[model samples]
Target: MIANTVRQFARVQQRRTLSTSVPSGVRYGKSFGATWLGDKGAWPVIGIIGGALVFCGSFISNKIMFHPDVRITPSKRNADIRDWR
Candidate 1:
């Protein structure tokens, strides 16, 4: 009798999966909250990688821009300027 009661309780606790189709990106409230990684998810990783790439690209660009023969100061504004000579 005790085994039968335990089996009944176990059956009550079992979850059923619905056969209905689920729409893409349709996040139920609790499921959405449960899936959250508290801001440590893909966005942060992409931001960090993108930031590093941008910083490195800017550094290389500045180096190329400021090369010795590539003077772009106001003194070299144009060939017709007196100071440019």
Candidate 2:
């Protein structure tokens, strides 16, 4: 339909000349592109932000729930006298 006509027109334009001289014994089309974030040190900032969000969310859930004042009975596997007063 109309899509095929636009694709054919674009293909004609892609055939324009664009080249660079290659060194002797060097292979072409064997390279890839990369970003510029290498050697940068920003991991601490990212980790702090993520950890703060998780802590805030946990605090909010503990503060605002359907049964905030109710005591939850522990399951048999997790029930230990030392965990209770």
Candidate 3:
């Protein structure tokens, strides 16, 4: 009895697989995210994107806070107004 039930479930699963067809571009793409990796199977891609965003945000914040490019001091704008020195 159990064997028959298991076989019937297997047949149903096989039928489902045969009936549904993945899109060509989603199935076959250059990157993992472009393909099924992020198409039907998108959990991994979501995790990757989330982690990358967090890391990138922290990196950018650190750069902005710790390393400032322009140091605005009290320098006169028209101190050296001579033309072609």
Clash count for candidate 2 is 0
Residue by residue across 2-58, what tens digits does model 1's lDDT show? Answer: 999999877766633233457575666656445554445766776888899999999
lDDT against the true structure, per candidate, is 0.66, 0.57, 0.67
* lDDT (10s digit) by residue, model 2, range 25-85: 4545554222222314655666788899999999878765534343454453355443333
Model 2 — which ten-residue stretch has the worst lDDT?
Answer: 31-40
**Error at 34, model 1, angstroms:** 19
Q: Which consecutive 10 residues in model 3 have the weakest lDDT in total?
A: 76-85
Strongest candidate by TM-score: 3
Give the per-residue lDDT of model 3 (tens digit) for 1-85.
Answer: 9999999999999999977967555543377545545465687778899999999999988876555452233353244552322
TM-score of 2: 0.32
Which candidate number maximizes lDDT?
3
Q: Candidate 2 deviates by what RMSD?
A: 11.6
Q: How accurate is candidate 3 locally (lDDT)?
A: 0.67
lDDT of 2 at 28: 55
TM-score of each: 0.33, 0.32, 0.35
